[model samples]
Target chain A: MAEVEISQLHKTYPGGGRPATRDVSLTVADGEFMVLLGPSGCGKTTLLRMIAGLELPDRGSVRIGGRDVTYRAPRERNLSMVFQSYAVFPHKKVADNIGFGLAMRKADRAVIQDKIAWAAGLLQLEDYLDRYPSQLSGGQRQRVAVARAIVMEPDVLLMDEPLSNLDALLRLQFRAELKKLLTDLGTTCVYVTHDQVEALSLGERVAVMKDGEIVQCGPPMEVYDSPASEFIGGFIGSPPMNFLDATLRRDGGEAVIEVAGQRSAAPGSWAAFAEGPVRIGVRAETITAHRAERSGALRAVTEVAEPLGSTTLVTAVLGEQRIKVQVPPDFPVGAGDDLWLDLRADRLSCYERDTGRVLVSDR
Target chain B: MTAAGTAAPDRAAAPDAGVDRAPLARRRRNRMLVQVACLAITAFMAAPMYLITLAAFSTRESLNAFPKSFAPADVSTETLRSFLGATGVVPSFLNSLVVGLLTLVLSVAIGTPAGYALARHVFAGRDAYQLFLLFTRALPIVVLSVPLARFFITAGLSDTVLAVALLHTALALPTTVLITASIFTAVPRDLEEAALVFGCTRASAFRQVVAPLALPGIAAASLFTFVLSWNEVLGAAVLTLTNRTLPAQVLGSLQWSPLPYRFAGGFALLVPALIFIFVMRRYLLNMWGTTLR
Candidate 1:
């Protein structure tokens, strides 16, 4: 139950061209689940390592529970971490692995036993307590690793893609369990993952990172609905948001963007900008398919149709750019069909054409 | 596919099938041939050791007889007792034990940290250091021993077991470091980092996590050191006179000794090494983890 404050943290390996982490600042409030989401080599793990005190930052500071501990060793930090590799000691039994931190702190035997039993029961690992790590399956081993971290009852917990090694079904199963467990404990956690779905499902706040810096940080839906930059917009979704370049205009006090030989009303907030070039980003679900005769709707020639039982995804080409529009499963659309896309103005976000930052209105 | 599906119902009668018996007989013969070859090699390796043990425990009359018998006619303790009673043999035997143990301790203590660093740390000249270790092995022990003997005498450390042990440690260190480095490399750094996050320091993490996993490999290296020091004659002879190791003492007077005395002394020198290997056999098993079958 501690707030983790990291400010201006930077780390660069010698001989590397760029810093691994650069000027990254973040504050995770008490009992918050903050996920650092990014692709590989994006410095999320490096940031987590620096906070754990396993790695030293080249610049700036780390404060845990309001105490500066940037220079302290990992042992002195009083925090626990679950590694991506599920680094349970092979020589120890599952019980011993989960109780290692308490043993390191020289806790009483009864207390250590109590904590180990509690964590194991919570993880449904009580049956495997006496078994060695090699005897357990991947998912079970990951649970043991989580049990090991949580048994310490640290002020904060750091996990670095702890479910990445498990198979698809196991990852999904453990992902839900982990979310529930983290909520039950209510300990401040800083988790790192490349999976956007996991970030959206587990994070109280998601910080999307790119090239060693935080590109956008907000609640999952906020970051999704209004990404601060083009990079965040593209990286945070499955079939990521679609971007179309268009010239904006305000005809008769109604804002609209002209694209592919047709004019469609822009997202409502774009009215703040004077008529000029802007990039419009709309999620797949926000763009709906309609009959070609609809007035003021942009026309796109459908390239492919993927009907996924409950919904159909139609990828269409509009003015030399590809955009995917989510439609109803029974929607009458197919490859080579010409249709109108009703771009929901209220659901769209507009960014500057060159700078890629959102055009925020004072209102 | 049809044959396999049809054969499933007659599985009980399939064991007596002539078609299957042909391949089964061939496989059995091939397996027998492989076992025979392995046993022959094992016998070839074990014969000399068995013969030496037999001769060492046999009567002097039997050992001296021409066209030596393969089997012991009369097993006796006379030859062993006389070899033990030989002047300077007992002291040299004790000295060899001390030197071997001391060499093992010194090499492992000095080489383990260097080995671990070479395995895990990235630093300037790391490859150069490894190359230097490999290059040291190219130097002949005999070539260095003479000068080392002169230096030891000048330093007033000659004619003592300590001098021989120090020389043995220096000779064994290169191999020790390389072997231990590979061993440490095999123990993942992830376990150590995990230990650190669980509240152990870097040193304690290595001790608590890495060391247990690497114990078998380290034990192998220690056994190598002990055998090396136990068998080394040139350096031990050159470095010591009064406190000679068993190998140096035996080799020094080898030609002059009778056949039974030579065999008995050789067997006596080998007993400790055999006991050591047997004692460490459990740790030497390749049981590190789940990666291997």
Candidate 2:
């Protein structure tokens, strides 16, 4: 296995008005699984392609296994990639497709045969070894593509939304299998995806990107619990973290936050910021709803209630802002009902109203 | 209101069966019409081949017989035998085959790379170059062939099969390039990139992935080039004397020859082109949609 070190990569298409990637730098340690997660057009794919040497960066350096290969061709980079389209050669059988890299390297015939069998077994594609890609189902073709890449045993494996093309159940099953297989093999991987759940589940570390720049990089749980900015908070979660307009004030060295005519204690770190208009960001599951009025609890009128099997998502109007709160599925709530919301002080994130930057210290 | 609501559905349901039956009947009629049209087109295309084959194989006296019989009666090969026995016919036929095959090779070899560039790259003047190819065809062959003949003589390449093949390659290139470009475009770019990532260089990737996928299309272009070179008379006639292709050699004599010999010559020219199309029909079908799932 090899570590991939990339530094100060920049690229802009000739006719594109904005750059695709802006001074992006990242490193994946030996045998580490790193995922670059973002929405479409955020340059995650561009960054991965640069590392694979499929695309040359306008200005940057990429070193794989301590060898500078920024200007090298993709073949010279000693890497393999699985595309979202599962680009298995339609003309070749599954066995030949998996053995293509070894054949290109002029490996021994017996070695190529052994490697094909091993990869086929790993991908559960032993039965499909003689089938062409055109004859296989979408999921099977994708497995063939993965087998093709892993059979190469290259320095690094790059995947660009490889599971995005599969159906929901197959994608979930394959995602879990892929995580286990890659972990067992200990191959250095740099994967790009727009799906948050895939990043959270498959990656040992997730690097979140936006507008062609890496916004935050950390363990998935840490990034989920303590996002670096409002964008990261809103982008990373389902029923994304709700942001409500509030005011922060200092009261006897304690941080007091006022929202919708109710005052509550805020996180201690918020005390460092000057008293001004701020936004209080809280996750959907962190807020509790009480039927009766309570001291220090903000009043809200519920607008919609959607029961999602395990949890009920309640959209409530608090003053002029709309916020979503996840409650127990059995919680009795509906539109037009008045509820007092208690935002968890420790879980609350304070953000600047004008800049959307987090006002509190990084956790 | 409840009675009227119930009555309205009943009224609607009563006509539903008739509505369905009307559409079914109309569909049947439309299918019949389509079949009739197809038969008409097929007959229109096949009639000439039928008449040519009949005339070429018939006895020589049958050509002058009044109220000619469409049905085969005296199916002697006398006319065809005499036609083949004529001086220079066999030699010219061989020359035509050489010129056709040579043109096919030269055009595809030169035009495929240009087509690949047009399909895969975004270099400057790309659109203008494509337009220039089309504009080359707009210049009349009749206008260009005389000067071309002179140029060939100056280059010491006149009156040769290679000279006619060169002229045919120039004539066939625009169509060949355009057709092959579209073929290459249909091949997904991801397959090529995947090959590159799997240790194949750009050239090898194209050879292994793109070329096999593009074979059917290249075959179609070759078929067009071969037939065009085989049948072209004006350019071949102007450029060659003793090395004339079959069409050029026959066109000069067939106008003064008797009617049966003319029919025999026409059948000879038609046979090779038909065989070529027969050979390439499967690849042409592949180009239409049966490839790559």
Top candidate on lDDT is 2
Q: Can you list the residue pairs that collide in candidate 2? A: none
Can you write out model 2's per-residue Cα lDDT over A33-65, one digit (the tens) per residue? 999999999999999989988888999899999
lDDT of 1 by residue, B114-177 (tens): 8899889999999999999989878898999988989988999988899999998998999889
lDDT at B217, model 1: 81
Instruction: State the local distance difference test value for candidate 2.
Output: 0.90
Model 2: per-residue Cα lDDT at residue A216 = 91
For A1-363, candidate 1 gives per-residue lDDT tens digits of: 799999999999788899999999999999999999998999999999999987899999999999999989988888899999999998999999999999999999999999999999999999999999999999999999999999998999999999899999999999999999999999999999999999998999999999999988999999998899888889888779998898899887778898865799876666779788888889999887896668867888999999998899899999898998889999998789998888888888888999999888875
lDDT, model 1: 0.88
TM-score of candidate 1 to 2 decimals: 0.88
Error of 1 at B228 (Å): 1.2
Clashes of 2: 0
Deviating ranges (above 4 Å) for candidate 1: B1-87, B260-293
The digit string of per-residue lDDT tens for model 2 on B1-293 reads 12211222344556564565666556666766777788799999999988999999999888889899999879989999999999889999999999999999999999999989988999999999999999998988889889999999999999999999999999999988987887888889999999888888999999989999888788887898899999899989889999989999889897689999988999999998899889888776655545532
Distance (Å) between predicted and true CA of A43, model 2?
A: 1.2
